[model samples]
Target: MLIGEVARRSGVSARMLRHYDSLGLVRPTGRTEAGYREYSREDIRRIFHIESLRSLGLSLREVGQALDNPEFAPSELVDDLVERTRERIAGETELLARLRRIGAVGPADWEDVLRIVALLQALGSESVGQRQRAALSSVEDVPVPVEALVEAALNETDPNVAGALRWALARTGDGGLALLAEGLGSPAAEVRKRAVESIARIPNGAATALLQESLTDPDVPVRRSAALALGARGVADAVPTLVEMVVEGTNDVDAADALTVLARDSALAEQIATRLVACLADGTMESSARRRLTQALAEIPGNTASHALADLSHDDDRAVALTATYIAKLRNAQ
Candidate 1:
């Protein structure tokens, strides 16, 4: 086959075939009487081989070595190609994500696009200050997309930066709630915790509803955080988890405080008092747990709490009796 026929059949351009010949990668096996280059069947086969190797990301020199060197091992080269392909894929994926985020912002002009890009870059910056500034500026001027804010919030390790991200997310309204809710089910414990923390800061009924649903999360930290946030919002459903917090001695103080807030309602006060009294009566209740529950009951104004404290004031454990006695005295003084 001649060069044009070779280019037409093999899909390798004539110019590239000539370049290959110049580089001695593939030379014509013969020439016609007019001195035009002529490729034999074996030469065409070598052209296909070069094209095949090039498709696998091999450079021309590498392709030549692969075709000519008898001792050249492909294992190491193949592994290197795999790694390089993975890196390229990762780079492309990141760029695609950046482009999607920019598009989500609905930029009005090139300036808006540039600002959004700069803000996004800053959000992922190595400097904590830049990240924080980006978070703070997200709600001002051209707003950063809530998706970016949520991503930052979930992965952020710095406390101040996380707080800013959550603040920025909250300002975006309830749009990020669904995304944050998905974070609640993440396999990672830290991510779940961050999700709950971010949701708690978002002051909306949707966020509160998500927190209510999170009350039964298998992760104790998630349940505890949700309970506290719900309790502050006066959701009575959080009472049980708050009670558990007091018993487990985890955030027992805040849990007790939340219970106190809930107890301001007359009906909830009686209900809360009854639960506390029952926890006190459980024989398996540890001494420390009993003491925390006793202190928690002190805030309840109903007769149930007073009667429970009065009974506890003379309990067998000296510490329990003393703490209960002090609390009873304070209740009487009120």
Candidate 2:
């Protein structure tokens, strides 16, 4: 259909439709021989999504800015980048405060590694990747859990578990998920759970259908296995099922989060952390969900999270407070 027909069908205005085109927000699929713009079914879908985000208070510039960089890190955009720079510095300080203690300990520094583990357990605000990278960045570093501990980390629901899983993926070459897959047959239920988590985090094409198979399992926990796997992959194929589960499922925080992580259809760990921050303002979520949301948001890089923070700050909700506090703290820390 042409602009008029698309607008009539999609409920978006023709002027707004053209404006979207100029902003690179949407493009015509074809043109009439007369040179008028034309759209296919997919283009109309894009138009509807543009309208929805704009309805959510995103300005044309903000929406376009969002398109320019789908990661939604506030630090990258001029509007919120300044504030984002600040929060990243503070997170580093927090990371280092924990690191200094680990450094004082001798050889294995096992206790310090445990100290960080304990702190992450206690605070629950730390970034899984940050802590994982800290320990794994250079292993003349700290050796908290032996390499063998990877199996145990997966089964645990604690968000910090991702850190341990990241290490196994880095060290194990091609055998990481293969190792996890074997764990499924082990006698321990935790082993099975952990294997599912690791497989979700470091995906293999052959593993997708395996994870999907888990969705219909009788066990509630196992059912969640497929959800998280699909989420970690950020596979668009799972979006419909995920969003449906989002509206109607429980005992599946990890799965729900995996889907939320796919907001822009990306699975990069850094970008996932950035989206977590913006989601803090989600009016649809409960209070506890919002708190966890803030922690994830706080972990984004200074350069990447700044712009996302600014746009989300304008959000007329409670997250603005949490966002502002993080921004101020990070700036002063920097």
Candidate 3:
């Protein structure tokens, strides 16, 4: 077959075949009387082989080495190709996500597009200050895509930056709630905790509902975060987890304050008092846990709470008795 026929049949252009010949990668096996290059069957086979390697992202030099170097191990090359392909795919995926976020902003012009791009870049910047500024500017400057904010919020490790991201997300209303909800199921405990923390800041019914669902999350931080947020939202459903926080002494102070907020309702106050009294009565509770629960109970106002505090004032544990006695006197003075 001649070069043209080879190019037509093998789908390798004649120009590329000549280039390959110049590089000594594939030389035609023979020549015609007119001195035109002629390709033998084996030469065509080599062309197809080169094309096959190229399809796998091999450079021409690498393809030549692969075909000619008998000592070459394809497994190593194949693994390298796999890694390169993965990197390319990751880059493309990131680009697609950026494009989607940019489109979500509905940029009015090139300037708007550039501004959003810059902001998005800043959000992922290595400098914590840049990231924080981006997050703070996201709402005030040009509204950023809520999805971007949620992504930043979940992955952010810096406390100040994370707080800014959550604050920006809260202003986005419930737009990011669904995405944050998905983060609740992340296998990483930190991610789940961040998801709940972000949701906790959004003062909307949807965020509240997500927090309620997160109350049962297996991650203790996630559950505690959700409980405290739900407690502040006046959702009585956080009672059990708040009680547990007091028992475990994890964020027990904030948990107690939330419980006090929830206990504003006369009925909830009684229910909360009863639960606290029950935990106080459990001999399994440590002296410290009993102390925390007693403090939380003292904040609740009702016949049940008042009576429970009164009984606890004379309890056998000196620490509990003394703390309860002090609170009881304060209660009496009120």
Q: Please say which candidate is ahead in lDDT: 2 or 3.
A: 3
Off by over 4 Å in 1: 72-76
RMSD of each: 2.2, 31.7, 1.4
**Which candidate number has the best TM-score?**
3
Instruction: Tell me the deviation in Å of residue 101 in model 3.
Output: 0.8
Off by over 4 Å in 3: 138-140
Best by lDDT: 1
Worst 10 residues of 3 by lDDT: 138-147
Off by over 4 Å in 2: 1-149, 154-162, 232-244, 249-334
- Looking at candidate 1, the ten consecutive residues that score lowest on lDDT are 138-147
Residue pairs clashing, model 1? none
Give candidate 2's error at residue 212 in angstroms.
Answer: 2.8
lDDT of candidate 2 over 67-166, digit per residue (tens) = 5666776444554544655777898976775555345333345565675466334323355555454434333443433223343455445555555655
TM-scores of all predicted structures: 0.91, 0.32, 0.96
Shift of residue 156 alpha carbon in model 3, Å: 0.4
Compared with the true structure, what per-residue lDDT tens digits does model 3 show for residues 1-334?
8889898999888889899999999998999999999999899889989989999999999999999999999999999999999999999999999999999889889988989999999999999999999999946567698889999999999999999999999888888999999998899999999999998887888888889998888888888898999999899999999999999999899999999999999899999999999989898889999999989987899998888888888899999999999998998899
TM-score-best of 1 and 3: 3
Error of 1 at 318 (Å): 3.0
